[model samples]
Target: MDDIVKQALAKWPNVPHCTGWLLLDRRGNWRMRDEAAQAAGAPGEPIRHTALLGFINRNYEADDAGQWFFQNGPQRVYVELGYTPFVVRLAANDPSGQLTLTDQADAAFEPSAVYLDDEGGILFTNRSTPARVAVLHDHDLDLFSEHADLASDGRGGEFRWRDGAVLKLEPVRKSEVEKRFAFVASPAAYAATNPDNASR
Candidate 1:
């Protein structure tokens, strides 16, 4: 296993349950493993896409200061978990509304606002468009907004002010692209273990 993968796995064991857990190889080609495949009816493929690549792409970001961000697309989706061993529950619109619990570690990166719904999912504005709100169905926004210095706009849902400004809005559903991009583990895993190489 690559050192980064080892570190990420050690840091976030829940990774195995996320949409995908990919390793960036020394050459820059992405190596992905789909955890959903472990169960029945799960897609059978490894997520390989040069465009969908980044250390903080699908993985959480943590700085030495102990703050973290749950990256979604181009935005660093924040969650609020008071102290170490941050725990939160998540459930998506699909999948029968089953809730999945996640435990995060405290690590800082950039300061941003994160919102949570009663169901424990995350809510945020589009990175390119602040006016357009997005709800990450199966995520924990409360964990990222716990200590947020900013206050919500008094709407039932959490809010952030001018966090991610609006530019243009285009939405893509995960299920729509699941087959076009997702893949299963392969021998490529050997060469695509380093983030730099994974990009190639």
Candidate 2:
């Protein structure tokens, strides 16, 4: 968390929280949802400000209820997830020609497991106690395809990085992803059942 944000929280300890006003899309875009967009179930406009994006990335966190949010100074702006909480892209500048991954937050990702979803999305998870699941950017599918060794059925395979690290690919159901990964996909709806965690 940012020091300024921490000071704001200390100064105003009970600021209201917000929900359904921000979204993290599947492609890793940060979207700002207005009232009309929220009512119409739209993804809203993508936020392109580099400084704002960096701020959100720095303060992004998840609550014990599996709700992810950005600590915007004093208020907690809950994020609506389009898919997984994180989206990863194949790193472009690795000198060894090995497959490397970086998350939307621009942090290096080392996967302990790899999965291919029913919809053909590539997902990666690490060995953390409560693992984070990140989907590979669709645009980088071709690059990933070159490194993956798939079965004749393309149902299962192995990903071989040029650096000699290998990961076995497994099958995953899209519907079961949230439960399997222990992440709440729609935190607004989740809060409906646990109203205490809802916006103030």
Candidate 3:
């Protein structure tokens, strides 16, 4: 949390939170949704202001109710997720590369769990506290494969590499992603929020 935001919260502790005003799109872009855009049920205008984006990304946070939001000074601008809460990309083009995991809010995390979706989409989570599940950006999928030191064995959804099976991953349905990862794709999708039971 930023110091200015903390001061604002302390000064105006009763400010109501704002929702449906911001969005984190599937490709890792932050968007601002207006009333019409929010009602139309689609992504809003992409926020390209570098300073504003930096502030939002810096103050982003999630509540105990599984609601992700940006602490905009005194008020909370809740984010509407277009996909999972996170998006990861290959950090380097090494023979066996590492991942750069960032949530919709742009906070970095160390990937702790790596899996694939039914469509062969990569899914991962953080190693630290409050783990958030995320999908690897599609544009980086080929880049990941090229340098990840990975090879798909002659088996369905099976992967093998020099270090043996890094993970015995299987494909999972997109519909089950939220439940499997303990996150809300949209604000309205938030059901239960028991952090203890959230997939680590």
C-alpha local distance difference test of each model: 0.32, 0.90, 0.70
User: Evaluated with TM-score, which candidate comes out highest?
Assistant: 2
Question: Residue 52 lDDT in model 2?
Answer: 99
lDDT of 3 by residue, 1-200 (tens): 89999999999988876667889888888999999998899799999999998898888778776667889999987788877776665555267544355555556656555676766677776666777777888887776565343335512343232234354455667779977777666663333343443322
Per-residue error for 61 in candidate 2, Å, reads 0.5
Q: What is the TM-score of each candidate against the true structure?
A: 0.22, 0.94, 0.79
Which is the better candidate, 1 or 2, if ranked by lDDT? Answer: 2
Error of 3 at 6 (Å): 0.4
Q: Which stretches of candidate 3 lie over 4 Å from their true place?
A: 94-108, 147-165, 188-200
Each candidate: RMSD? 15.8, 1.5, 5.4
> How high a TM-score does candidate 2 get?
0.94
Residues 21-129, model 2: lDDT tens digits: 9999999999999999999999999999999999999999988878899999999999999999999998546575766788998898889899999999999997677
lDDT of 2 at 160: 80
Candidate 1 vs 3: which has more TM-score? 3
